[model samples]
Target: MREIELSLNQTQKIRLKRALEKLESLSSKANSNSNASVSISDSIPVNLEDGVLKGHGTLDLNGELVATVCGVVERVNKLVYVRALRARYKPEVGDIVVGRVSEVAQKRWRLDIHYSQDAVLMLSSMNLPDGIQRRRTALDELNMRSIFEENDVICAEVRGIQHDGLHLQARSQKYGKLERGQLLTVPPYLVRRRKQHFHHLEQYGVDLILGCNGFIWVGEHVEVKDDMVEDQVSKPEQQKSNKNSISLEEQEQTYTPIETRQNICRIANAVRVLSILGFNINIEVIMDTMNLSSSLNLDIHEMLGSEFCVLVAEGEAERRSLTKRKG
Candidate 1:
């Protein structure tokens, strides 16, 4: 039993991923019993292929297959209930899900997460980390949305469930605005059902929230920089000694990485063309608009780069109709 839980090596990891993928598909739709007239048992019968029904059972909590119902197996036992197969990482007591502030509600922020409405991140529920005894002032008149601004991305905890939607709390420094960097979303199904961990980019040094609803955000760890304080000192000699540090920070600026800038520019240009033309801008349009990549036949390689701007401004004036219409 102990060995069963041992870590899987890389090859084993891939194999397991493949196996889980198959299991996911197979478990989605159970096969019907061989004989049609028998009605295939009322529920999922657990008949193994070419094997006898070991007995009617349920796959129980402790991960052992156990019996829930009693009946004669017409064929192999394949009937099943409780479709909680791939329990990879469902939301639980204190999971931090990354979500964008969708809309400002009366007292809460409605986030457009793929979860079961916009999950509510209640203001009062936020971290008074030193606990209830840390109440410094009158807390009754606290407004919810004031703490969090509109469209601000927040990392929040799955405080609990109130209604069908998830309840959230963001009292800690861990749960706050995501700034500077960008976010990326993977398929919720892929993320939730990953038997293996979703690969993380170590270089980015960012916080990630894998929401049960499939929303993911990766960005610089705001409000937590270890070297930030050391970067500044009042003494001239100390400041002179850290000239390299200043240059390092400056080096980090001046230009975004090449590929990142390229992608950003390309996406911006695509949006520009799309909005300006008010039409479908194909590969041709993207290339032409960006002015970085070629529009010629073999330019497909340059078409895709991930630097997409979160927000782009609308134009001031419509391209004055260059129309001299003659049929």
Candidate 2:
């Protein structure tokens, strides 16, 4: 049977997710009549021939535009085409995507962004040897992973969309690379379509890499590998093989005290108050403008700056709103 696919926006996707959850929650509240009688009017509005009336059998709807189908849905290409609203996206070229820095090659990185296959980055895509005439490295063998490093969150532009994956290129000096911090992954069903700048974060390190195939990895930073070792472990390869095993101490993460957090917040709040007066947000810009001491204000701004920077790095403005929400 012929079928149709429903395309929805980010708002529609979030709405559907919430609606589905609500239905599951209210399952126990179903009301039953003492003498249940089958009524054609109450039954799902099913029609095999002509199209069913728009929104025939809606159970729970937050907004009028969103509704569930009360009839049969056909499956094509393994996708069930229901008479319900759905979120979708269209692929295009030159779209900037914030994907997890997956496998880093000699000159490229593979992004695990829930696509058919991994995306690739080629050498000569960055501004490293910028404004110069010749290539930066004389050695053609310089590895890409070493330059960008593995799992270093990065922002790149989609050069082309392929059946397998995306052909990506890094943007300018401003729009590449990320540090260790928290991230969020929204369900692919909730995302509407491909966006231009998708690494939106809200005054935090919540970088997002929305994928079309519905796979996203939310991580602050890829934990650096355990390359650090005891004195003996760094010995030559042959010498290490000749020696016995070495004991490595586990490193405990140092936690920031609550007092420290409060102090930072106090200064940040003060800055926010001043920001209401039309001051810019950059740490240097605001600090110099306000003549606030960096010893105090700079630290707080640095903390908040990381969060705000991620919001500006995103592919879409609407998607950034998701990051702006409080915990």
Candidate 3:
């Protein structure tokens, strides 16, 4: 089993292993009777008479169906595929993802989203920062850096996979550059696809983006402003007033609040602890872990301690046991 690197004593290690074993038992019961996991080049047991269709991670070998990767097998009707846990993200249409700009190419931006290849965000696919919709002229192409420069982290959607490559789009206000946050990377399998990925924690004043590509973003909440109306209002004001006369005091006022910053750290640490534990990550589980920390009066740093890790593991085991009973 894969385990995170931690400084664990003998007792803590034993406890953690016991919890992990219990979790495995729970998961094994929920899965099919026949082992769904397979190794590379393993021949899958499929009825050829029923007409088996090979999907991703599987290849036809003479007459037998063989897996091309080591992963769990999933069968949907007659179509069979392997869901590889350690493989690069395989994007589907409309998957919300978070990525960092690797390069600003001619008319497209290359983003590193931990895929087999970098994803492309064409100039035409995104809305202008000022919320203007028009033809993308050479001038717009030249001013691309003004919108998203190199190394800027952006949230976008998987438009589709073309013959050329994977494509992404950010056409709405919600899909844009992220700021004042920490980006956490984990195995893509931990984050299950769901209807809603963008979450605003009103109590904590933080924004969480559970990207389908395993890039998790936790940041201060940013209000979605009506950029079109603001653009219209500011255009006339720009024509009448000087634009470059901002004072240092006004710039300093844009700083994030100390409390909000603390909240951001707390939430981010909670995610990091969960990832280190190799647990399934969701809003409910994350918030529950946070509540656990608070209930025990564990400081933000103490959450990463050996005792806390063991406690979290034991807690997760109990939670899964309860879920199994409910099921």
Candidate 4:
């Protein structure tokens, strides 16, 4: 368990301690049958006759498989490995990830996806704004910064690892330059891979993207418009105004509503509390936490206080217990 440093009174401390203990108890009971936490040098049992294959975080010493790191033991058919709770993000093909542009290379943008190495986003891999399906010319290479520049946050898919390095692609409009949002990072282990990572909270008018690399993006929702339609509508207007002149529509687009901004902060604080408590982070859990705070009429900043944290922990424990019973 992670220790939360807060200016908590004696009563708050006792409640928090009790809540955390309950959470720990529930988690241990649920995972007891399927998983086992091990420390370095802990001997892992294996059927020697089956000829076990040792994977990462495990070492074969004197015909015994022992853990090389402190983590939970995972078995995949014949392969046995340890999954470290705290580690760098490992990329997988087709996985949606959010990253920041580290360098704008000649034809590719290097992104830091919290991986062992920086991921590459090539100019040729992504769809251009014009929605054209043509070859990337030298002009495209020269105007690469027009698409993405240094330190710009982008969402892309893990294309695959090439000879150069891990490559990312933004073939869809949903998979590019994030704006007007807070980026919160938690341990990758807390964010499990799921079928759908993109969520549009219509009620709050917010977008939540649970990036596979443990990058949580909470921003105002931007409707995905057809590129051809947008181009057709804007071309005539573009001809009327100077290219450098900013339009009123563009200015309004840049301005986020105060209500939406508050919702973003409130949702973001829920994530922070969940991460601090080491709970599994997902869209449902995040929304539930937000609802809990709202029902109590707690302010956004108050969500991070010791009392709210304790309440969240207790609620989580109760939820998990009910889920286990139903199962």
lDDT of 2 by residue, 117-182 (tens): 677776665544332335647463354444466666555666886564577775344345554332
What number of backbone clashes does candidate 2 have, counting pairs of residues 3 or more apart or in separate chains?
A: 22
Clashes of each: 15, 22, 0, 0
| Residues 36-89, model 3: lDDT tens digits | 778899998897778888899999889899999988899898899988877767
| lDDT value, candidate 4, whole model | 0.84
* Stronger candidate by TM-score (1 vs 2): 1
Cα miss at 94, model 1 (Å)? 3.4
Which of the predicted structures, 2 or 4, would earn the higher lDDT when compared with the native?
4
Per TM-score, the best of the predicted structures is 4
Off by over 4 Å in 2: 1-90, 129-143, 162-165, 193-327
Error in Å for residue 193 of model 3:
1.4
By lDDT, the best candidate is: 4
Candidate 1 vs candidate 2, lDDT winner: 1
- Candidate 3: clashing pairs of residues: none
User: After aligning candidate 1 to the native by TM-score, how far in Å is the CA of 154 from where it should be?
Assistant: 1.3
Ten-residue region with minimum lDDT total, candidate 4: 231-240
- If ranked by TM-score, best first, what sequence of candidates would result? 4, 3, 1, 2
Q: How far is 119's C-alpha from truth in model 1 (Å)?
A: 1.3
TM-score of each model, in listed order: 0.42, 0.37, 0.88, 0.90
Instruction: Judge candidate 2 against the unseen true structure and give its global Cα lDDT, from 0 to 1.
Output: 0.40
Candidate 4 residue lDDT tens string, 162-203: 899998888776677877889898888788889888888989
Off by over 4 Å in 3: 33-35, 40-45, 58-68, 226-244
